[model samples]
Target: MIDVIGPWNRMHHQDTLEAMFRLRHQVFVEEMGWDLPLARNGRETDQFDTARTIYLVYRDEDGAVAGSMRLIPSVLPHVLGDVFPELCSGPVPRGPAIFESSRSCISRKARRKDPNGMIWGALTCGMIEYAMLRELDFITAVMDRRMVDMARVADWHLNPLGPERRIAGGGVVAVTMPIDTHALDTVRLQRGVPDPVLSLRFAGARAA
Candidate 1:
């Protein structure tokens, strides 16, 4: 299950957090080789992973973390403030209309078939789940380039903020997802986008 984690649940999910960080290092550092100039320890983290960050994790039967993601509410603190102000001519978002989701990573080792797809679904679910819990409307983010490109043609509603560019070490772009808190977790017959969305539903949870 992909569990929504706040500071209240961090202690129970320490192992999951470790695995999440490890996977993040793998993808954002070793695999992508992003020399994050903003990193404190030369890691991929920006100013986003602070106390205001919301963590989402999916675990396996083997008790290892499978998927992970982090979110920053635009109404509160967010990356558009400290990181990429150039996304807009004036200033980045800090409104109730948007929530920034980031720090997404899936474990390298597979716990099931198509680990990447599983991670995407879990992360997407986590965003929807958070929106419902917090009574928000939109869950957006400055996404990686590939996701932005793929999302452009998806059934999911989107608003593009930036083109793909190499800013963070290699290059990544920014995009937004207009998440409906009422969005169903179950997969729909979607057409468009090369990477398909995850077929997922929260256990014991129904669509709002």
Candidate 2:
């Protein structure tokens, strides 16, 4: 079985955090050919990997990082608002309720065997589950246009913030998705998860 958990306290979960970085390096730098700078130690990280970043990590039975995504508070310096302001027409959505999700990575090995798309669905559902636990309204993300169809199939309420634009990986769109029961159920069903994917444990908190 897969183990999914997060909004992990980075300070308290340093080992797991390191594993996540390594997985990101493998996915984004080695596989995707992204030009982003890697840490001298060979991990993919940036200014965004700060205290405020909340993460939802998917782990295999042995507890190795399989897939993961990072969530940043909209009010803080995030990719959608701070890095790609031109992508949105008006003010970027910012508040305690809305969060910006980015830096998603699913290991190549996992993808090779994820014929049912369960890993992707699980990560997506975990994000919504995290929002529910925190009483948040929704999540904003700069995502590849391909996800638009997945959102449709999964019954997610994705409201596009603006038109699609070409980015590093290809065409991408900004979207705001609600974190409500319908959305949650849709994601869970899509992932084949009968219940929650996120297992919460409090250590401390920070913002990205």
Candidate 3:
């Protein structure tokens, strides 16, 4: 069984950051051959990493980073609005409750029978718990095509932006998932969120 937990910005987070970089390089750069030439620092990062964000990392029993992702508030640096401005035609949503999910890649070395892998589930659950604790208004994810169906399967509130499509990693479509007031009312209906304790971090008024 994998142990799921949060990494504070202090010790655990530092290690997690390194692990995330390595995983991204391994998957996005070496194995997948998407990043072209490797980076001088051996990382696959963008402006989103430095934004107002919280990272959730999954590690093995040996404490090695297994998979990871990040959460960014829409008010700040979201991939679609802040970074990938070409995709949005109008004003980006800034609901005081919106967070954009980014950098959600797992370790390529880790094998999985599923499409997105187990880390995605743990990260989503952890983000929900964290959102409740922080009183966040909403959570969002920029959905590349490959994971759009996964979002639907997971019962997340997702939709495409229409017209413009960005495909990466072998023709995956792009979309988004927004967890606003409507989503708050039905988070439990989402798959793999049975244990309410997993949502303790993002609970309270924010969850309502």
Each prediction's TM-score versus the true structure:
0.74, 0.90, 0.71
Superior by lDDT: candidate 1 or candidate 2: 2
Q: Scored by Cα lDDT, where does model 1 land?
A: 0.60
lDDT of 3 by residue, 1-208 (tens): 2222333323435655666787887777777777544353778776666624566666655778777677776777667676555454555566766677776766655556335344556666666666656666556555566566656665664666544464563433334555443443344445343444242333232333
Tell me the deviation in Å of residue 197 in model 2.
1.2
lDDT of 2 by residue, 1-208 (tens): 3233334445577888888899988888888888896454669999887766788888876678899989888878899998887778778899988889899889988888887878888888888777776777889988888888678766786888888999875999888988898998888777786576766634333221
List candidate 1 stretches off by more than 4 Å. Answer: 37-46, 75-77, 162-172, 181-208
Error of 3 at 181 (Å): 11
Supply the global lDDT for candidate 2.
0.79
Model 2 pairs whose backbones collide? 52-207, 52-208
* Candidate 1 per-residue lDDT over residues 99-125, each given as its tens digit: 788777765665355633655665676
Residue 200's lDDT in candidate 1: 28
